[model samples]
Target: MEQPFQFKQFLIHQDQCAMKIGTDGVLIGAWTSINENPVSILDIGAGTGVLSLMLAQRCMAEAIDALEIDDKAYEQCVRNFENSSWGDRLFCYHASLEEFADEIDDEYDLIISNPPFYSPSLVSTALQKGENSMSDARKKARFQDAMPFKHLIESVAKLLSKNGRFSVVVPFSEEEQFIKLASESNLFPLRILRVKGSPSSEIKRSLMEFTFSNSKIQSSELIIETTRHLYTEDYINLTKDFYLKM
Candidate 1:
């Protein structure tokens, strides 16, 4: 069943997109810091324009652009942006990160994304064409297409202003690889938070923040729950402003 259109402190209407508003997007949006007080922001692969909206609510950026390659997702993102109070500051570009990075004239003070990371898995038949379109044309032709996490990071590095920040959320297993890739692009890790379901569970996701300069990195853990039905105080504190039922 489709969820109702709901509004939160930092999130606006986001119901029409295939990707509903979720914790991953919310966490990254709220957690990402603007150390230099960015004047411009870019959100790559913005499924429902949630990240951009959050940033708009939190910062007074001159312009906030969201790029989505998928047609349906792009359309929905535009709608979500238009409906928000910060609609004038937020704009949706129906283009992929590669294309946007190439044509955009100005660099961003902050670049963020919740990239597609599923790799070497069985894709559903219904999404085969969409998956193929996301893959590099040459790689798709060779049947070696994979989610382009590296490409995303490299593009971000090119489009970020000096002293800018890049933030993302990826699976815990990919944190090391992601850090290595970002380093190659001259984007060094500044902070990392490992997220686990419970105290005893393995870390399932990592929220990472990087910058153009090499800074002393801070690492920490976030346990979402103390039990199946109970959320940890820290988790609640982090998300209380954005979750309606919290």
Candidate 2:
């Protein structure tokens, strides 16, 4: 059965995808900077192609390309892309980041990723609690070994255009290590957003953006909910246009 996620502008068919659409993808997709009027964009590990679709709807970027490694997710992402209004301008490549980077010599003006966060050796709380059943696709979607930060940063260094921008979302605790790895590849932080579930809750996720230059970093915080199922005004404002009921 294909469970479809309803968005304001487009519906995403994601039953075949192990990693369904979640707040992290939406947060990074909506929060990533796009002011430069990029002519081409790339979505790394695009799950259901939501980020590419959102950017296509939000900007005039003529080319929105996505890369996915998982067999099922890649097919679903292609289906989602072709079903969208921007199908003529959108395309999906069924390949790993390394494979895509190795084959393609073109640079992207904007590249975005909501990469797998947990290391292959670690199990997430959701997995331990039985909330998410671990599978090959899910593991490949969330494991560090599947797409290491070092590999991702190095690819960005080579694939991103000189004036391009790159963005991603990962666990807040990994922020320091992720930035350090990026700096080694000469990709400096441009903006950082630390996200919390509630005002009193500990920081949960970090949404980061980078570029080739060592520009002044813009840092900030985002609280998604003031209480369970109740969103903050800022959160509402940031994602209102895309979420059906936001």
Candidate 3:
């Protein structure tokens, strides 16, 4: 069995999940704005419910809901949530974003996601016969076609409260396109944090926070390491609360 990822206040068992615990999820969970003191928070595509668990530990949100589409992932997510210290506050729903958005009338005060990031060409190749045979679980977890940017943005717009803020981490290359899609739904970017593996490496990811109303954008950059396995001060400071050895 895969060991659970031990955080300062919680543990996440991701043995059944297609995508294991990753830096992107941790970054979004820790970096998401809780300044509004949200009473309810939603985590879309919750794999092992790690993001929801993280939020529950970080804030006093009474309702921390997660939505997962994959069967195994959903089951693991629920199990992980139940095992956490804040089980009362964490709940997992096994449903696609579209179905959940259409059925649920309640709105969330805060939303977070580490969405799938495979490129279109790669997704196309995966679909072709005799190509690199990716498993169904991993396909759904990593391919954008499983939960397209337009669909995600539209669903989030409908499910978010008027003052709610949505935070997500996506490929830096998709930042421009994703923002355009979000703007179509009136979700303006409030902050953008570009992340690089090292100071010399190219930006690899974009952590973005959005809201209903437009405002002056707060843009910044983060380099995770100064050298191999050597974390940078900014990365450590930002994640010190959740990471055990920070």
Candidate 4:
């Protein structure tokens, strides 16, 4: 059985979310820049509503909306949002990104997502395989499925307010493709941070932030740990507020 959920000072209750609270969410939450003090924010695919809660705590935004497609995750996200100290400012919707984008008339000042990055892959367990197959079948059936990377970038370009920013975490291998896709959609990359397990290890993930305006791209690297037993100072500093054991 899964362990009972826990709450941190900065994090509200986070239970019943298939994707548990983890370092990647914290990294993206901390790394995203809120230069304009966005009045409105959107968290796409907000599994546990952790990212939305973090933004609410970090910035003085007037409204924050979290979107989740999975029924269980959406319900959990709603519970987490309502239980948070900033419950009045936080809200969640049980809808896919495409559906939300289509219905949303007002543009968002900031948008963020830790998207579903896993491509089609085989699973070993029979139950797991069955679930994967069902999800895949569902995807294939929808003419207007949740936006692909290219479509996601395009939608962001259309939905972001002028001078707005979009931040996301994607696999390191997809960085080049994503950059190209964003460029094609007229969203220029403003900043990028390549994440590695350690200083000497290969890059594992990429956290990128983009803006509507054309600007010089800034790139940096983040090393999470020096060794398995030692966490890097920078890593700890970024997530200290959220991680209980950090």
CA RMSD for every model? 4.9, 1.7, 2.2, 4.1
- Return the TM-score for each candidate structure: 0.86, 0.95, 0.95, 0.86
Model 1: residues with Cα > 4 Å off, grouped in runs: 10-16, 121-147
Residue pairs in clash, model 1: none
lDDT of each: 0.79, 0.90, 0.91, 0.80
In candidate 4, the residue pairs with backbone N, CA or C atoms under 3 Å apart (3 or more residues apart, or in different chains) clash, namely none
10 residues in a row with least lDDT, candidate 1: 137-146
Instruction: Please give the lDDT score at residue 159 for candidate 2.
Output: 96
Estimate candidate 2's RMSD in Å. 1.7
Mark the 10 consecutive residues where model 4 has the least summed lDDT.
137-146
Clashes of each: 0, 0, 0, 0
> Best lDDT goes to which candidate?
3
* CA error at residue 203 for candidate 4, angstroms: 0.2
Model 1 lDDT tens row, 5-91? 564754445444556677788889888897678999999888788889888888899999898876767887888787778988999
Model 2, span 1-246: residue lDDT tens? 766999999999999887899999999989998899999999998989999999998899989999998888999999998899999989999888888899999999999999888854355655787836677777777777788888999998899999999999989888999999999999999999999999999999999999999999999999999989999999999999899999
Model 4 Cα lDDT, one tens digit per residue, 1-246: 565345465444545565677767889998899878999999988888889988998899999988888787788788888877899999998887778878888899999988766543212332364554444424432212344787778778888998899999987977888888898878888999999999898998999999878899899999999989699898988877667787
